[model samples]
Target chain A: MDNLFYAMIFIIFLTGFWIMLRQSNLIKKIIGMNIMESAIFLFLVAMGYVKEGSAPIATEANPGLAYVNPLPSALVLTGIVVSVSVTAFALGLTVRLYKHYGTMDVDEITRMRSEEL
Target chain B: MITAHIMPLTILLPLVGAYLILLVGSKHRSFARNFGLLTTGITFAMVCYITYLVSNQGKMAYYLGGWAPPLGIELRADPITAFLLLTFAGVSFFVLLFAYDILPGEINGKVITRYYALYLVLLGSLLGIVLSNDFFNIYVFLEISSIAAAALVAVNGDKLAMEASIKYLVMSTLGSGTVLMGIAGLYMVTGYLSLDFLAGALPQAYASHPLTVLMTLGMLTVGIAVKAALFPLHVWLPDAHGSAPTSSSAILSGLVVKVYIAVLLKLLYRVFPLDFLAALPLQGSLLVMATLGIFIGSIMAIRQRDIKKMLAYSTVAQIGYVFLGIGLFSEKAMLGAVYHVFSHAVMKSMLFLSAGLLIKYSGKRTIADLSGLGRVYPIPMIAFSVGALSMVGVPPLAGFMSKWYLGLGALEANQLLFLLVLLLSSLLNGFYYMPIVIGGFFKKETVEIRQEKIPLGAQISLLVLIAATFFFGLFSNIPISFLTPTVQGIFSAFGGGI
Candidate 1:
């Protein structure tokens, strides 16, 4: 069952990667990248899960119960921030690129740039 | 205890500088430049002191917020990290100096301060990448530097710059994602982010899950290969480096790309044990990729008409040399690779600065159009000639020393085929590099070109770098001593000593 969960997550990640690599539109590529990043975040958060686990926080009641690992959760928070910044920057660059080239397609941009050179 | 403080301080000083520049120097252009210089200058001094400490005290690791490795992030300063930090500070200072004069010509005053602020943040992030000892910390720093570097590439606001920046962003983001996934894989298996702890736990995990380990290595290598612009993965380099401002090109090529290589080295030797590496074909494949990078990078460089783009391709070839040294894996060869890192940093940055000077003064950027200005702008041309000679492995310059060491490494490893590749690449380097020198000095004037005086700061920076290239070549022992222990540290980590 655990192996099945890992497989599902990996398949989603690969789908995102395919879209990122295969897409011609810049916006689609960015969306694909976001999807890929989300898959990793899911994988990380899943790693911290414990069977029948409650919140990692401790209180007087049920202190002996299993608690999910919190370290990966903490780590993924940082990862999400990084992912957002990269997406923000990529979108900003896309805006400038569209402004200059009048196209949102990577193929058109490449063709136009090479022609200019 | 006092020495331990330097490890985190090296990263912190640059962070403080970036914030200061953004807040105080955002409105005033000159103030931004001065603040950036002062910050980098002080950081260089601190790096020198840290190098002194490492030489005396050996490896020093600092924990954040007074927490130990498992609970908090750790930053380690070994010989390699210290030397790399020092090189980063020195090269960045000079690149900033060069940019001071050249940026105004390429960009408008409105964005200049912001550009400096981004440059400071980029430098800080680079320092973070070198100093951090935790897996996740390296990923965070890598993203910061990648974003800042892409912004710097597009800061010129030209069409080409924007296009190049977008291409670079997409490729580098993929690289970062792979790296993050790889790190997550390691963390999930070992339950540790600290490199020291991971090293201890990895061998046991490796015995149980060899395929997982191999996949992690593959992901990390391919990710970093894209970031480092290794061979087939280098599509974004020429465009981004060529289209960016001169200073950005210099820093991006000279230091930014090499930082990834350094991180890869740290992982290869520190995080993964040598015996484990023996089961993998990483080194063998690296040799093939590097060979392609050498021959193909040079051949492509020969086809470029634009001077900066030509230099950009030459960088691809030069990176090929560093990887070749790594592929050899002999003690002497590894040393040569590390030395080449320092030599190439100084020489390449110097060449870019000189080329910037030529472009600024004469408005000529093609090899054919550079005629007669050599006689007029003798200082920059002479320095450019020094850089060209060094790249071609002319004696008494740094490039020659690295090539010689790489050759000796090939002989020691009994991979004589690489020796041939090294010689052929040098010849190819001469093919592309010498024509510019010859054209500049000997060829008759084809166009009406008037020489303008070189800026004071840029001139000083170029001469200093030229001197450094010579110094590193003639007295190669100084840096080799600094690098020997780094290699030894790796070897010792694997229960071997050089």
Candidate 2:
């Protein structure tokens, strides 16, 4: 059961990787990057999982109760911020590229650029 | 004592300076250049102080917020760190000095403020990468530097630069994601984010979950290799470096790519046990990839028509030398690798700055158009010749010293083939670099040449870099001796110390 969860995460990660490598549209490529980052975020969050653990808040009444690790959750916050910034930056570049080339297709852009050269 | 705070201040001063520039320079444009220069200059002083302290006192570690590791972040500096910090701080100051006159011309006037802001942020984050002793801290700084660097490349706001910046961003993001996943895997097995704690826990973790440990190592290696532009992963580098402004090219090719290698060295030595590294096929694979990168990158460089693009490809080949040194695993080879970091940083930045000047004065970007440039612009052409000779491993130049050490290292490891690779690559380097020097000086003018007065600031910057190239080569013993103990300390576990 534990292994199955990991296998699913691996599959999702590969799916994102494939999208990044195979996508022709610039927007789709950014989406692929996001998916890939999301998978890693999930993997990190899942690593801190304690089965049946409650939220990692201390309560006097439940002082001895199991609580999930809070560190990976904190790290995932930073990771998400980084991912968003990269996405924002990539989109900005794509907008500039589209304005110049008048297309969102990577292959088309390459052809146009080469033609200009 | 006061020294304890200096490390964090080295990083924060630049970060604060970056924002300060954005605030003030937005209103008053001229302030950006002077203030940026001041910030980098002061930061360089602090790094020098830190180097002095480390050399006398040995490795130093400071805990953030007075909390020890496994709970709080740690920043550590050893001999290797100090050496690299000096290289980064020194080279960046000179590059900024060179940029003072040239940048306003290359980039749009309005974006100049933003360019300085991004440049400082990139420097700050690069320092953070070298100083931070935790996995997550390095990752965060890595992303920051990556973003700042990408922005610098696109600061020209041209069609080609925009496209190049996007490609660099996408590929580097993939690298970052892989690195983060590797960190997560390490955390899963060891429950530690601190490198020291991770190192202590890793052997035990490996004992219980061998496959996970191996996978984590593989992930980290791949991620760092991509960022460092090792071998097959360097597809995005030429476009980005070629399209960036001159100073941007110098910083990106010279310092930024090398910082990732610093992180990799720290990880391989500090976080992983040496014997375990030896037991794997890691060194063999690194050696193979580096050899391929050396030959292929040089071959590609020879085919480039654009001078900047050719230099970018040359950077790819130079990086292979550093990796080759690391893969040799002998103490001297590691020293050569580390020294190459400094030598290449100085020589490459000099080449780019001089190239930028030649292109600016001649109004040409192709190698063929550089003919008769030496007579028209003697300073930049002379600087370029020095850089070229250094790159070709001419005796008593910076590049020769590093290659000599690397060759000696290869022989020490009984890998004579790489020594041959070292020699052949030098010949390959000569093949590409010699033509420019020859053509610039000896060939008759193909087109009318106009002489324009070179800026005093650019002249001073180029002269300083030229001097530094000669300095590092002649006084090579100083840094090599300084780095020896640390390299030995790292290889102590392998047990055959020099």
**lDDT (Cα, tens digit) per residue for candidate 2, span A1-117:** 888888788888888888987998999999998898888988988888999999998878789898898899999999999999999999998988988889999899999989988
Q: Which stretches of candidate 2 lie over 4 Å from their true place?
A: A58-64, B494-498
Interface DockQ per candidate:
0.81, 0.88
Best-performing candidate as measured by TM-score:
2
User: lDDT tens string, model 1, A1-117?
Assistant: 988887888887888888889999999999999998998998999898998899988899978889999989988999999989989988988888888888999899889878976
TM-score (chain B) for candidate 2 is 0.98
- What CAPRI-style quality would you assign to candidate 1? high
| Clashes by residue pair, model 2 | none
DockQ score for candidate 1: 0.81
lDDT (tens digit, per residue) of candidate 2 on B136-164: 99999999999999999999889899888
For model 1, give the TM-score of chain B. 0.97
